[model samples]
Target: MPPLLAPASRSPWASLPEDLVRLVSWRLLAGDLTDYVRLRAVCTNWRSATMSPCGRGVIDPRFHPRRWMMFAEGHGLYPGHERLCEHTRFLNLDSGFFVRVRLPLFKDHCVLDSVEGLLLLQRDEDTAIRLHHPFTGDIVELPPLASHNLHMSHPYANLPQLRPISASVSIDAGVVRVMVIFIHLMYAAVATSQDTKWTYLMHWRLPSHYGPLSFRGEQYLVHETMNIENTYLSQIFQLEAHSQDPPKLIVTFPREKLCYPVYLVECDTEILVVGHNDISLTHLAVYKLADVVLDRFIPVKSIGDKAIFVGGRNLCVSSKALPTIVGDTIVYRHPREQHFMQYCLNTSSWSLATDECSTM
Candidate 1:
């Protein structure tokens, strides 16, 4: 018999097939976006694989610390050139450069929130929606609710089946795909933590606006919640549209009796943002479409308390908190630690490069 010999060492990465490796590389480029952005524009294969569920992946352990800010300056010589106009307009938040879009003008509007590379700006109640890419100046106008069909006649029953509409954007490789979701759940997550995790909501594909069955539209709104109950809510009610046909409610928060302001933030994931209200004893209620259902809330106080983000193997929040006149306001977070230790988005987050972040 041959002398016993030590088993040959197995290479940890040797068993993974080439296709699996390709998928993973593509996923890393897409999922680990803090660094992979430059690579996304390198090839079409990488671009296609990362823009969808099949080839896409969740946030990478090695990603984040993405220090993206709106830049405002450009080469001075070509100030008036048509090609250089993109860097000339001003966005709601002064990211440094001016942002000019070619969509119809909106009035009494507010820039709600944004994700990926998209901005969720709303005006005229969600009846009129616009999907615009900040860099490319591409705009897609979302269709009005099914109720808008009644202008032809008061016979509102002829309106097609109404479904909740919302928008989401994900960056894969370098390709930014703006997605439209027509589903029942405002947010999707695995029903349980221990099993195969899959988004619990069903993705309903209505005919695109190009087809005969097309009653579809899109927007950049986030935190879309609706209460199927029959309760008239407040403040948020100011954003409603007036028409013979009522706009179908989209579940935004989850409840109605919300007595306080439900603080909302666009974190890295979609979770029911409930607060512990370290300061106040009341739970703030914002509108979820229209009805009020306090039971649907995830019991917490001031609103969403924990925001889970990561940078490489390190899991952390994007910002930090410091003692302020009011209370503990987020100081500077991880990737942006060098600045903005006391400011937040839409507030003093960008008042100036050197102004005290204490007040925006």
Candidate 2:
């Protein structure tokens, strides 16, 4: 008979190296807070290694966090899950995680846009705009639309139909600045805490859609226009911080290749202009600004591993952020329809996504 071997002892998790434990903890940071807490409870070494996670762990560039499509008004449907509650639902395509976020502040407000996890809300009663963070529960109110003169001769009823088409926020040195554009009025308004009233920029209308982009501590309003000769031009305006001066035109597209319905997106610390062909609405042209001062836009075939979401608001995210979201794709909702559509950059194809409200 073989000699009896001593029972092997189980290695304690606390014996693991601190660096290894920290690396494992970093991955858990993207998950729910409860999961991170549970991970730290496993052993003393892990608890000490992950004690400084702050709120959410720093996002890993190589493996980006999944991007979710947040419904502003109603709930979203997952492929295999039951219907979610109303208010706001974030649907993760890769993991099929449909989460409903309750926002008491948004009960009677219309969601105008979403950026960097912040929702731009407009009140139904008086068109009061505010920014609310669903995750942090922080709210910042902007100057009411009623404060600004619509310049209309008669009293305008149905103010909700004239909601601001675009809104953007910037924070610097612990100060918050917000910009809102009212397309019908052809006006852009800026408000800062130091100012007693909102500053208005008039006669700054673009023929097509426009949005705001904050880059490198500067605020820019980007839009497209048509010249007298029927040429398409992409325009960029630089808004001076806390200044009452009108926004200055800093850049314009050098060529007439682009069409209407242009959108500006900031990706990888650079600016990208997206334009759709008006005739077909099938082809999209993407350009990268090589030199903003020179107003140069170089055509590009692909946007690298980034997927852009454009509609009432514009968002750019990496494909690695969500496994099911394909790279070099554009996801947008039609203005007239309730369904969502996706455009593939590689194949130049169009397809409809699952409609969340259709089931209701």
Candidate 3:
């Protein structure tokens, strides 16, 4: 085949299957998803696909869509034969349905990402991929990380002490870039080693030659973790690949002191971040990776419900109101501004614009 291109008269998106439109559009709307569980549940067109992720594009249009989630097969960390997981189940917000895809290799700990109709996964140190086909159980493996730094995941016996661990992957310039942000959580309990208690932001190429690996921009990010005081705050850094020297880092605060789950969503222009799960993150804010001053929490009244991600571009932060419990934290939309509203659930309503990290 020479090449397939959609007619110029038609918008590329015009010819896209309704499923494609919804998938891409949802990612544009929802930032970092807790899981793409709901999106994948719509209809058979959204779920059942034949051929190798059939579409006119060079890559499988279905699998390579922006944001997707995978389940790590087992209790341990990393994926492999023991760790079996697949991206079959999809949650559709349009219709309340959960589609399930049965797969293996997501055994131990499978980190899944969808690209070009194929599900790419990372298990511990290695990488692999599988194509989605309903009738047949077909899968292919990719290559592994280019290099391994034992220091990245230093075992207690191997190094003086391994304090912290963090990893982020970004696909830039057609390659999958991987970076690990390690922090010194503890001093050596045993011998004395000159281990600096600084965060190491490391990167690597996904030169996964081991299995059905065809990843391009697999590079690791190297940077230092930022901490306000001696106490580690509830924050994590986002890696930007297209920067000078090493990629740029965007550190965000979810909850003040607790290490709750922080999600980083890459919208078409702005990066949307949601800090949830931990009750301390009753606040939400947006920021540009380049502008530090623009980063601040949105002032709002706190709701007493555990804000489980409901759906859509909007998020509902809620908690349980107990008679004896007193509000300790206040949500200020404009913390730097003079006015402060002690976050009360009923009075707060706000959204962040995707084009810019400004109030909506």
On lDDT, the candidate that comes out on top is 2
Residue-pair clashes, model 2: 0
Candidate 2: clashing pairs of residues: none
Ranking by TM-score: 2, 3, 1
Question: How big is the positional error of residue 229 in model 2, measured in Å on the Cα after superposition?
Answer: 4.9
In model 2, the runs with Cα more than 4 Å from the true position are 1-69, 72-87, 91-99, 123-129, 149-158, 193-197, 202-232, 240-242, 254-256, 276-283, 290-296, 309-312, 317-325, 331-344, 347-360
lDDT of each: 0.31, 0.60, 0.33
TM for candidate 2 is 0.62
Q: What is the TM-score of each candidate against the true structure?
A: 0.33, 0.62, 0.37
Off by over 4 Å in 3: 1-88, 93-95, 107-109, 112-147, 150-175, 180-237, 242-360
Task: Identify the superior model by lDDT, candidate 1 or candidate 2.
Answer: 2
For model 3, how does the per-residue alpha-carbon lDDT over 179-291 read when each residue is reduced to its tens digit? 33222432111100111222233443221111111122222221223367653344332233223233323343434422333333332333333333345454443333334
What tens digits encode model 1's per-residue C-alpha lDDT throughout 255-359? 333422233233333222222232232222222221223335343222133222211111113322211122212322223234433323223232222366433
